[model samples]
Target: MKKFIIAIDGYASTGKSSLAKQLSLHLNYVYVNSGSMYRAITFFALKNGLTPLNKENIDRLINLLPEIRLDYRTNNVTGISEIHLNNKNIEGEIKTLEVSEYVSLVAEISEIRKFVVKIQKSFKNKNGLVMDGRDIGSVVFPNADLKLFLKASEQVRAKRRYDELINEGYTVEYKDILENIINRDSKDTKRKDSPLIIAKDAVVIDNSELSINDQLDIIIRLINSEL
Candidate 1:
């Protein structure tokens, strides 16, 4: 069996990560949540007091990039891969609303994108891989075998994110999540480097009204066709 790469790109809270993870498990591919890489860097910056990453401190952050070590380790119990920063499991830490607030800003930096993209591109060496991010298809892996661009209405995406945070024991307002989604969309699409856009040959999935299983079935069919 020949293995191929799947690149999933989309706006924040559009379920790109969820779908990509599912596909990875189903296909027995290495799953990479590219957004988590950005979040880890953002969390690091926040911990080190290097943000509101201005012109003055941006260079400092860039210099510190070599010190950042990111990798994924699968949990034996849940069988899910969790991201680690500096060999420490920071998956739980990076998922906070605080990290969410700054991730897009950190990702907008060209140097940050280049650093992460270098790591992202290396994953393709493994052959069978599923990676999801704002620019995975458009920038990181333009020749990916299958590229999916996900989209949903702002209200729907916000509600999904709010439910996720609430279930995680975080007290968050839906309005705030909605605003963040809107703001992230703007920043992601307007960024001077690697702005989020659908690859010309990519398939777009508007999952506003679809269930996870529905999405899985649809994507599985697409994968079969590709195979």
Candidate 2:
């Protein structure tokens, strides 16, 4: 059986990662979350107080991306490969709102995108993989066999994000979360390097009103046909 590369691209907190992971496991394919590459960079920036304006610093960061290995270690109980950055398990830290603020800023850097793209390509060489990020379908893996662009209304995505932050013990406002989502969408779409856009051949999954199981079924059917 020939394997197909599944590329899922979407905005933050849109459940793209969850769906991608499930599909990968079901199909026995490798699952890669490309956004974590940028998040790991932001984690480094915050630790070193490196601002986005520092072009040289960003370039230095790019040079170091190869050292930031994103290993996924499944939990002893929950059975999920928690994201790890540079031998350290920073999944809890990377989910914070501050990381959210800087991710787009860092992602907009061309050098950073170039560096991350290099890693993404290595994982897709055999094509039995599912990768999700803002640019996977349109830029990083445009030749992927299947492309999914997931989206929802701003209000819906914002509320989901707000609840996620609260559950994570962050003191945040719903209004602020909504605004942040809007700002991120604008920034992501306006980004110079591989801006977020629906590819011409991409299948649009408007998950605005669907449950996870329903969404999974729809996508599974689409992929099964191709496989």
Residue 130, model 1, lDDT: 91
| Candidate 1 Cα outliers beyond 4 Å, as residue runs | none
> Tens digits of per-residue lDDT for model 1 on 1-227?
78999899988999988888778888888899999999999999999998777887788899999999999998888566889999999988887888988898999888889999999888888859999998988889999988999999999999999999999899999999999989999998998999988899999999999987899999999877876
Least accurate 10 contiguous residues by lDDT in model 2 = 72-81
C-alpha RMSD values across all candidates: 1.0, 2.1
**Model number with the top lDDT:** 1
lDDT of 1: 0.90
lDDT for residue 171 in candidate 1, whole number 0-100:
94
lDDT of each: 0.90, 0.83
